[model samples]
Target: MKKTNYHTHTYRCGHANGNEEDMIQAAIDMGIEELGMCCHVPFPHYRKHLIRSLPSVRGVRSLLSLLKAIIKDGPNMRMPYRDMETHLELLSQYQKSYEDKIKIYKGFEAEGLSVYFDYYQKLLYEHKVDYLILGHHFHKHCISNDYFGKEKMTKKDIYLYCNDVEKALETNLFSYLAHPDLFLIGYNQFDLDVQTVSRRICQKAKDLNIPLEINAGGMRRGLKNINGEQLFLYPNAHFWDIASEVGNDVIIGFDAHDPSDFNDAMYNQMIKFAQDHRLHLIDHFDFLQGDFKKFQSEYDIR
Candidate 1:
């Protein structure tokens, strides 16, 4: 049972639990062949102004410094880019130390900043990121500070999210699409609009030859009931049903926020989901096996 998940998160993202080593051990315990430490990429520019100013000017400045300290500690609250250097270092060290046991990869789950492509480019050039997965968790961009918060997405918003995803894919930077059906999180219903967007995404993925993840994080979080039907926000039956027809490469994501959740159950569920949908789920990705330097040169990566 060789399996790999390139959509894992770290404590630096302010949401996920566990240290990098903890995650590695958890992966080993579950017999995972490869584990990718794909923490959220930092948007330094977006973070600088996200934290509100305090009542007093000096106090506000103090707050900024304090937030910076927290970022330094790897919490990544109001600042994100601060900890990436350390994240890379940790991954590199752990990968070398544990090479005998299991395969480990260093990368980021990037929500590309379309408005600030230069900043995104800067990060790529600055760091030797192994791979980038397009995880579109926001509406327009992460800078909008807008979570996809509506109870039900309007047709316009659905298109916006899909467009953002397309833009990220066109950059030719991402190795695969993470949680491709994430747009359905807020949008509980399945209709023509959702189907259309899903097809558009799958079409691009087919064209690009990039794999789309059948994310397991949603199942670990718990199922949601919409219109009396139980389903995960992503790995939506409707979306995958369309994906099967579109014929895009698919992979499973552990999305391991807490290392303990990376278990046999998680692996089995992904296989079961893919089987139920008739998706040609990939057991391993060749992209993860090549030389990083060669990949960078080939894609002009950065």
Candidate 2:
């Protein structure tokens, strides 16, 4: 295990326990070499709204009710931009402080292209973000903030999700995808039709050179007292088996939401799984490392 965690979250969004410094310290303890945080974008009730509009998620009204039920932690909960800038500043500092042990990148766990495509295209150029990790939290067809598991997904919704899978790669806005199989819109566990959507998905990823995350967050869900409902990390073991067979740009991340999640127990088995399946890790991504230099030339202000 390389101890490189590319998928991470912080306190500013909602879940996740640590601030940037705490995450870096945990990464150091875990011997993590590269750490990336994919925090949520600000003012996302509308994003979730787009996901709900999809025919895939059932009980849309109830889902909106659930989101509306979100209790304000403090006074500024209503204002997302204020919180976003504060969080971005903290992200920048963490990168500077932990420059030695880990190469930290500015990023966000952005919603699908349906919601943020227009805004994200600008943010990618404007914020100089290093990468964008796909987080399919769509409630109607795939899992939503209100629901988990596959009870709501329909074949059409699955198709819609599959299309988004392609769109995430096509948006030309993200570097890697966090959990590609989170929703499993079109294919079954290992029953993926390579000629169909899976093949296209891999082909596009290869063509565009976008890497997908072999997230270890799913394994953490098995832990007791832990909240795994919406946080992505499950492997969809069979889905990855096929993805590894078809794609070479696969990457791995702990998808850690907190400092305590930096333990070996969280990632050891997944590393073995990725190795067994022959999935490519982010560290091995040649184009990304090289393109990053170019990306830096174009975007890095400092």
Candidate 3:
């Protein structure tokens, strides 16, 4: 398993546990050589008035309601992440702390929203972020904050989700797709409709030369049994089989939400699962490692 994970979260994300240093030490203990601290990037929420001139009271109420439903701990619960300046400063410290042992990269798990494209880009341009991973957590069709797994997914939902993912890939903004099969979270079955969308996603990733993540976070959450069958919502057996067939670049994302998640046993299990499926798993990605050097130079990151 090479001991590298780019899909890690921090305590500032509200739902995730542990501070950045805790996760860093955990990775070191697990013998990780590289760790990317991709904390959740802050997202902006628009007021109804800003978009359509709705009543002030109505706008506030609606925004609050939407935030409550979508944000696990609500809007004011956490900073979501340190501000860009602070984030970069922390990254410097973490890197210096483990200079000879592990490589730590600064990045964000950003939402793939056309509306927020400029916002994300601003971060990259102004903050010198190392990379951004595509995490289509919210449905962009309506720009709602509702997360993918919070609702029962229909084929229509699957279509919209995959479409958004494809759009994100087309932008060439992300280093890789985080939890590419996340649309399957609430979907219990791998029906023909699901298969169709999954195939489309894999093909698009192949076409774009974007790596799709086989996230291990779901394993930490455990498995779901549907129709007397043990199934995982993601790192989905069916999806990977299609990915293996499509010949898309695949990589493992620990999606570590906490320090404890950096366990060796869990890491080995996920790697074994990918090997069993014959999915193309690479230890590190050029875009994330070597290619990013060019990216940083282009952006004048240093």
Computed on alpha carbons, the lDDT of every model, listed in order, comes to 0.73, 0.60, 0.74
Residue pair clashes in candidate 3: none
lDDT of 1 by residue, 182-249 (tens): 77878878888988899999999888888999988777767778768988777788899989999888
What local lDDT does model 3 show for residue 67? 50
Candidate 3, 1-302: lDDT as tens digits: 47788888877766788888899999999998988898777655433212332222134555665455354432232233335467568879979978898999888887777765655565666546777889888664223334576437777888888888888777777879888888888788889999999999899989888898988877777777866778776778888899999998888888888899999888888888889889888877755322223345334542
Q: Can you give the TM-score per candidate against the true fold?
A: 0.82, 0.75, 0.83
Model 3, poorest ten-residue lDDT window? Answer: 48-57
Evaluated against the true structure, the overall lDDT of model 2 is 0.60
Query: Which whole-number lDDT from 0 to 100 does residue 199 have in model 1?
Result: 95
Q: Residue 290 error for model 1, in Å? A: 16
Model 2, residue 263: C-alpha shift (Å): 1.5
